[model samples]
Structure formats: C-alpha cells, structure tokens
Target: MQRIFANRARTPEGWLQDVIVSVEDGQIASIQAGQTPQPQDRRVDILLPSLGNLHSHSFQRAMAGMTEVRAAGKDSFWTWRTLMYRFMEHITPEQYEAIAALVFMEMLEAGYASVGEFHYVHHQPGGTRFETMTELSDRVFAAALKTGIGLTHLPVLYTYGGAGEQPLSGGQTRFGNTVDSFAELVTQARAHASRILPGDARVGIAPHSLRATSPRDLAEALMLKDEAPVHIHISEQPKEVADIQTWLGARPVEWLLNNAPVDTSWCLIHATHMTDKETRDMARSGAVAGLCPITEANLGDGPYNGPTFLAEGGAYGVGSDSNVRIALTEELRTLEYSQRLRDLQRNVMIPGEGSVGAAIYLDAARGGAQALGRQAGHISIGNLADLVALDGADTALCAVEGDQLLDALVFAADDNVVTDVWSAGRHMVRNGRHLEREQIVSSYTRAIRSLIDAI
Candidate 1:
C-alpha cells in the first residue's frame, strides 16, 4: 500500500484541495480531500487523471520525420503510406520491441498512461506467416512490460490490400492474416495478455480498415472479439472513401453503419469525411470518434466535423496515430486548433459554455478508457490509479486555478509541465522523464540507426 498527497487534484466532479490518495494492488484504494499528508505520503502540487491514447502505430515512431518531403506528383496519404510501407519492411521483431519501448516511454513522459496500439504487422517478409503467428505482438507486450506502460493491444486483422479482397501488395504483405489465422492469433494474444499486467492489459480487435476487411469478413472478425472493444480505420482519406464507395456501394461510415453493429463498443478512427447525416448517426450510435488530429494534419487529411459531431452528442478522444509526435496536450491542442481553423473561431471544441480544457480532458479520458475496455479514466476509489502530475513551478501555469489551470496546462504549458506519471500505480515517469528512458532510447536509437543504414 502507498499514499500520495495532491495539493490540488482534478476529479471527475471538480478539483479538490489537499487531497490524499491511497493505492493498493495497482488500484486506487481510497481518495479523500482536506486531509493532512502523512510523513510517508508522496506529495505533488497538481495532479490529474491521465488519458489513454486511443490509437497508435508504435513502429511508425521510427519513421516520424522520414516522410515529410513532397512527392514528385500529388502528395497525399497514399503517397505517405508508400513510404511507410517501405520503412516497415526493415523492422524485425527485435527492432519492433526496441522502437515500441521508446514510444511507450515517451507517451508516459507526455502524460498518457496507456496506449491502444493498433498493431498490424504480423508476418515475416514477403507475406509469409511467422512460425509463431503472434511474434510481433509478443514483442510489443514485452516493450509495454519493460516500460510499465498500460497496453490495450489491438492486433489488427488486415487481410487485403484494398476493398474487394485484393491480394496483399508491397509493404502490406507483412500485415496480412486470414480470418481463421487471425482468430488463432487473437486467442493466443488474449492468453498472452492475461499473463502480463493481470487485469490491466486488454487485447482488442481491429479490422484494419474498410479497404482491408470486407463486410462479411468484418462480421466474422467481430465474432472472435466476443464483448471486447472493436476499432477500425474509416474515412481518413478522400480517395479511400471513394474507393470504399466504389466497392461497397456507400461511404465508409455509411457502409459500416448499415452493415455492422457499431455501438458503444466500437471506436471509428478518423471518421473525417462524414456527411452531416453520417456524423449525426455516428454520434447517436454511442461509438467514439478516435480523432488523431496531429497525424491527420501531418498527412494532409482534412479536419473532422467537430461542431456537428459534438452537437449531436458524440464521444470522442484524441490519439497519436502514426505517432509522428507524442504529446498528450499537443494532441488536445491540435484537435481544438483544427476545429478553429475550420470554423474560423476560438474555443471551437466548446461553444459559449463550459471550460474547453475540462471538456476535452474529461471527454477524451472517458471515451479513450471506454475504447480500451479498461477500468480507468478517473481517480475515484476502486479505479486503476493511472495518474499524472504537473510541475507547479512551471511559468506557463502561473497563478492559474481550477479549470483555468487546465486551460494553461493544455494550451500554454510545454510537455515538461508533466513531472510525474503512474500507470496502474507504477511510477514509470518521474520529473518529466521515464525511469528507463536512457536505456529505452539507447535501444531505440540503435535499432532505428540499423534500419536507416539498411535503407
């Protein structure tokens, strides 16, 4: 058992002063405000419930800055993906573990306690299945264990290169798995996941995208998922949407809404090109919109319809998809900024109403936790103690209090403002750096350098 004191702690209801939190067996044992700190209690200035990244491709961290150059003609997501496919070719299982360690550690430093890794690369080179089908997944789980970061491992079932069950092509060869093969992988993955982190690690199913999984195959994959959360990439690219329409007779979201049971258990990533009705229908379905604003902007995908989506009461969360960058606050900042750039107004995430920071922080935490199928997203008693603390002395938060403090932290403060993080009560990050950062980064640098040299 351990105790921590927060001079100010943000709870779901509101902020509390001089609060004491107790942890036992990696869950919050109790929480009460107006309590004197015990001599053994760890004290913090400001604390908040940490958010989980709803989507990530951890290997893409290795290729963060490699694809920014303009193509000879028509630069877009497909062009960017061609480069991504090429890069994934060089990542061995050993390299995947090394890169994912650094990526997860950085997420801890940036105040994300958990990540929903949208993992897809499941084979050896040239479309050959590995002798052990879940080898890459084992590597990723090892990285999560090495870093003490919570893992929601979404082993993606990517069977085709495009809509209509197209054969695997180019770099995508490594990501293919037949539905029967995928079921075995998921079964082994769940058994493997249970051995680590006990109740905290979740293994969800991802059907890559509309292009990668046909409607019939998607339904079959969902059967393998049981009651676990389901996530899928949908409508991130205009061309992809057009292609799905050509094959499925409807837009990506439209087709899914018509064919699948997309309810609260689903997370539709990058529903970026939805029509007004699609947006409203999606919001009403109680599924989360897994918005990755930084990656979308980086890839030139247009902004999501935030106003219409929210007005229709949608659940949404921000992700570091592609992981080109990994800053929790920066994701929230970019999400709101993208909305502002579209609507040409400030505070686009909220209207003339509540605190934007509180709304973004709370909403994302709730939706992300839901999508990850975890008992997280709060500091209440019996909840997993996934928490983050800010540096009170940071100049960016000078004299800020209550929701305004959240405003400064989310919009003004740099990443260093997050001084400590706990994933399921494990203090993996302290003073704005992961405890194993040096070793993790060293391994990552060596692995990336080897890949770069090969290229």
Candidate 2:
C-alpha cells in the first residue's frame, strides 16, 4: 500500500490539483483531489496514467538499424522482410530472451506500462519444435518479469507463407505449425504463463495475417481465441490488400468483418490503406486500430485515414512495432505528424472532448487497454496501478497546467520527459531510467554481438 500526491494529476474528470492517489494490492485504491498533502504522501508535480503499447515484435529490436542499407533494386516492406528473415534465422534462444529483455526495459523507461508482444518466432533454427514447447514463450515471460512491464503475450499462429495456401518458404519454416500443434503450443504456453504471470498476464491468439493461413484455418485460429483479445496483422501494404482482394474477393478488413466476429475484443494492426467506408465500418465494428506510425514510416507504408477514422468514433492505440525507435512522446508525435502531413494541417487527431495531447493519450490508453484485455490505462480508482510522472522542471512541462501540459509534452519535449513509472504498484523506473538498465544493456550487447557474428 502506498499514497502519492501530485500537484496536478490527470484523472478521469480531467486534471486535478493537489491530488492524492492510493495504491493497494497492485490496484488504484482511491483518488482524492483538492486535498492538502499528507506528511507521508509521495509527492510529485505532475502525474498521468501510463500508456500501453499495443503491438511489438520484441526480437526486432536487434535489427533496428541493421535494415537501413538498401538492396540492389526497388526497396519495400517485402525486401526489408527478406533481410529480417535472414537476420533472425540464426538467433539462439539465449539471444532471443536477451534482446526481448532489452526491449521490454526500453519500453518501461519510455513510459509504456504494458506491451502486446506479437510473438511468432517459434521452434528452432531448422524448423523443429523444441522438446519444451514453451521454450521461447518462456523468454517473453522472463523478459516481462525482469522488466516489470505488464505482459500481453500474443503468441502468433503462422502456418502458411502467403495467400492461396503457399508452402512455408525458407526462413519461415520455424514459424509454422499445424492446427493441432498450435493448440498444443498455446496450451503449454498458457500453463507457463499461469506459473510466471498468473492473473496479471494475457495469453492471446495472433493469427499472423490472412496470408499466413487459409480461410479454413482462420476458424481454427479463432477457436483458440477464448475470452482473450484477438490481434491480426492486416492490410499493412498495398500488395497485401490486392492479394487479399484477388484471393478472397474482398479487402482484408472487409473480408474479416464479413467473416469473423470482430468486435471490441479485436485489434486490427496497420489498416493503413482503407476507403472511407472501411474506416466508418471499422469504427462501428468496435475494433481498435493498432497504429504503429514509426514502423509504418520506416517501412514506407502509406498514411492511414486518421482524420476520418477518429471522426467516425474509432478506437486507436500506438505501438513501438519494430522497436526501431521507442519513445512515448515520439510515437504520439509521429502519429499526429503523419496525419498533419497528410491533411496539410495541424491538430488533426484532437478530439472535441479533450485537448489535442490529452485526447490522443487518453484514446491510446483506453484502446490499448481494450486490445490487451487488461485493467489498465487509467489513474482512477479500481484500475491497475500504472502511472508515469513527468519531470515538472523539464522544458516541456515546466510552465504548463492541465491540458496544455500534455500538449507541450507531446509537441515540445526534446528528450525523455518521463521521470518515473510504476506498473502494478511496482516502481521499475525513476529519474527517466529503468532500474536494471546497465545489466540489460550488457546482456543485449552480448546477444546482439553473437547474432551478428553468426550472420
């Protein structure tokens, strides 16, 4: 149990001054604003509910700057993927866990209290299942445990190579499994998750994409869905949309909405290219648009219809997808900047209900919590105790109050403005750094060196 008072705290009813938030048993016990600070209260100048990152490939953290060099001909997501496959083909289990630990730590330090890891690198280098099915799953669990980031383990189901049931090609063999094997894999993964994370972690199903499985097997993947949230990569590239239309007679989002039970329990990753109807229909379907702007820009994926989507009442959350760059302010900034560039205007994601910065953060928080199926994204009573305190003296937050503070932080912060973070009542970062940063970096350097040498 703990009590912390903030000079200004972003509560459900807007920012409140001189607020005391109580945490007990890893949940927000109570929030009392307009009160004098107690002698024992941990006090800060500014506090806000931490954001949850809704999509990630933790191992890709290693390949962050390695993919910058261009191939001989035209470069695109497909070409970059070829290099990714080559880079990952030699990663040992030790390297996988090490890289993931580094990534999870970076996320915590960046003010993200939770992550939905879209894990797919299963089996060994030669496409053979480990004697222990939860071997790599254990890596994700161990990384989360070491870092204190809330875990939403989305173990992916990757069966085929492309549309039309294409055979698993080289470098994709390790990610393949039959329906029966995947079920067994998920069952064992859950058993391990229960032991490691208990009720705090989510073990959800990720059907890699429409191209990774046939329509028939998609049903099998959804059968493993249970009550957990469903996340699928869809329509990220124009080529993917065309292939889906050619193969299924409908675009990816259109086909899924028509065929599957996509509701509030689903997150559609990178629905980059969509018609106005698709945007409206997606908003009405209650699915979260898991937008990863930095990764999209890194891969040259086209801008999404952000203005239309939000106007139609869509839910959205940002992610550190490729781990190329992980920063809370940067992700939010990039999201809005991309929209601004597309629309040739500013303040594009601002909601009528809140300030531009507060609106985006709140929406991302709620939508991220929805996608992760976690009791988080709020600094209110009975919600998970995940909070971040900004450096009140930082240039971005020094002179602002209420909504303007967030606006400045989002648009003006030059460095990490977050000073501290607590996930589920455990403080993992303070003074803008994770507690175990040095050790994590040591492990990451060793692991990355080994992988680079192997490559």
- Best-matching candidate per lDDT: 1
Per-residue lDDT of model 1, residues 1-455, tens digit only = 97889999999778899999999999999999999998999888898999999999999999988898898988999889999999899789999999999999989999999999999999987978778888999999999999998899999999899988898899998998889999999999998888865578889899999899888889899998788889999999888989999998999999999999999989999999999999999999999999999999999999999989889889988899999999888899899999888889988786449889888888898888888887888789989999999988889887788999888877898788988899999988887789998899899989988988988
The residue-level lDDT of candidate 1 at 142 comes to 94
How many Å off is the CA of 262 in candidate 1?
1.0
Question: Per-residue alpha-carbon lDDT of model 2 for 1-455, expressed as tens digits?
Answer: 88988888987888788889999988999998898988998777788998889999998999999899988999999999998998889998899999999999999988898999999999897698887887998988998988989999998889999987899988899899888888988888888898878467899999999999888888988999889989999889999999999999999999999999999999999999888899989999999999999999999998889888888899999898999988888889899999989989988896564678888888898999899998988787899988988887887678887788888988888438887888888789988889999999999999999889999
The C-alpha lDDT values of all candidates are 0.90, 0.89
Identify the runs in model 2 with alpha carbons over 4 angstroms from their true place.
351-354
Please provide TM-scores, in order, for all candidate models, with all chains considered together. 0.98, 0.98
TM-score of 1: 0.98
lDDT of 2: 0.89
In model 1, state the lDDT of residue 398: 71
